[model samples]
Target: MLWPNATRVLSKMGLLARLAAHCDSNTHFLVRTSSGKVLMKIALGDFDVPAICVRRADLLAALLSALPSEQILLGHEFRHLEQSGERVRIHFADGTSKEHDAVIGADGIRSRVRQTLFGKSDPIYRGYLIWRGVARYEGNAIEPGANSESWGAGKRFGILAIGEGKFTWYATLNTLADHSDSPDGRKSEIQKEFAGWHAPISNLVDATPDEEILKHLAYDNIPLRRWGVGRVTLLGDAAHPCTPNLGQGGCMALEDALVLAKCIVNHNSIQAGLRRYGSLRYSRTRHIQQRSLLMGHIGQWKNPLVVGGRRVVTNLLPARIFEHNLRRVYSYELPGS
Candidate 1:
């Protein structure tokens, strides 16, 4: 995910240096080599976000510096939760309830508000799975850059530069349509999926011990009917559970938070503002969610004919067209009017 715009937002708001200390400027991206084989490669993705995390922590501390000691509490849990129009009432596990003007659920994909207000939907398991691991390198062992994904029939792999002498790589594969799994089943699945891949992928997978490998059952949430039901609002994976194919899951969450904050800051009535927030966030997120699923299906195609179909489309299209299509998503802004 490209994050220069977020850094600009921080810089404009005077949080640049705080963010720079912990975040790395390195990035890696997906690309095809001239030899026409899919492999781990690099481009730019981590250019300016993780470094900003330092500033974020500092700001949180600085904001908390003025608070009185009596106001701090820990080890609390919610025993009961209730939501009405424009506010959420949280009943403590202990018999206390507090009402807030608006509640934002930024928790995660299996968001309670999303399930409660919108109801839980079954996660659509695409006929695939993934393996991930991190590796350390020195002195540009694989070059300097981020944004790399090597696509192939029924599988693809990408090595993302996370800065600080490390990289994160994950590979996705098409399993049997009905293959359910177990704790150790993923190892066998990976060995089968990647056995035919190139040397770089094979090397990376082989270099890592089995214990370090992470398994993710590929899934996309069913599209919800609403985002914010009332005074309550949902953000991030709670709002739109995007497939990792596009790598915009985190980026979209960040955008949702910014837009929601901006909307509340600009509007007088919290309810109207949050409703508008839903309207504003819904279409964009839904489009991204659907497109990502579509993209994943395309990448995970198993048949030779479908594989050729994708290649034809990818070749017939200019790289600029892909860039242009993504630019609109990458370059979004809140409506100022």
Candidate 2:
């Protein structure tokens, strides 16, 4: 999910038109109970730029298309790194090595670059698993340009329309870590978990082929005290991984790229640029990490009383408050913009 802020960044890069062609511009965000009771509705259209939903592959294709083909190295798996005085040498699993002035670890949550820089540490499991799938639904069961998340006891289901009669859905359930399903049983398990949820959810699951379903245990790292040292630094999930509660994992990474670029050009040396990037990003990403964790906890509430109270509180809260919060997130601008 690309929020307004991320889209704005892309727009500045001149890639919005290409990306928007494959995405659906989201206008409203709806929060509801498992049985389809609406608790809150947030108008995303109030923002200057609209939120967009696109398949990850589509987004990647759009981004890759904008870059030169030869510049991208395919099938290179990072194994470790060695940093000399002013250069960093990267080693890949294929026994290949390369040297560069600086290394940016945008690798991801299990970043090998991060481990080589900081000591190896496992990401914390947030006691939940998420299953994602893309399905084709021609029915008008779901409203166009609307994204909705339905909350149940210890489970949550989110549906995002990604244009062209395709919708992306994610289901989350509180569970022990490192859980696995039998061969080809992921779709069945998800269907069973969300069996009684509202309409279109089941429809989406049914439409998706078993092989297309993807499942993973949700994990995130505690905010790092430092993102990089010397000529090596981290970005996105490598620096701070957050739960998907806010749908900002990718969005934050987009923001980081822009800020990091600006910082590098504005600073005198590579090390200084990396330092400024980490310092500028630390507080904002930390706050988002903490906020997303809290939201996941609240959404996973299982007790009837607590869930009822949450719904009541959310419903009673003024729309302006929600709008203000959304604005704070979506209104972010690149430095000196």
Best by lDDT: 2
Residue 282 of model 1, lDDT score: 83
Per-residue lDDT tens digits for candidate 1, residues 66-114, read 4676776555544436877656796665777788876777657766656
Tell me the TM-score of each prediction against the true structure: 0.76, 0.95
Model 2 TM-score (2 dp):
0.95
lDDT of 2 at 267: 84
C-alpha positional error of residue 298 in candidate 2 after TM-score superposition, expressed in Å: 0.7
Q: What is the C-alpha lDDT of each candidate?
A: 0.64, 0.87
Taking the tens digit of each residue's C-alpha lDDT, what string does model 2 give over 1-337?
Answer: 8898998988877888888886777888888888887888888756666688877887898789889999899999999888998889999999999999999999999988889888998999988888999999998768777899999888999999888888899999888896878565888888888888889889999999988889888789899989999999999999999998889999999999999988888888999999989988898899889989998999888888898888889888876677778788888876631
Q: For all the candidates, what are their Cα RMSDs to the real structure?
A: 4.9, 1.8
Angstrom error of the Cα, residue 78, model 2: value is 2.0
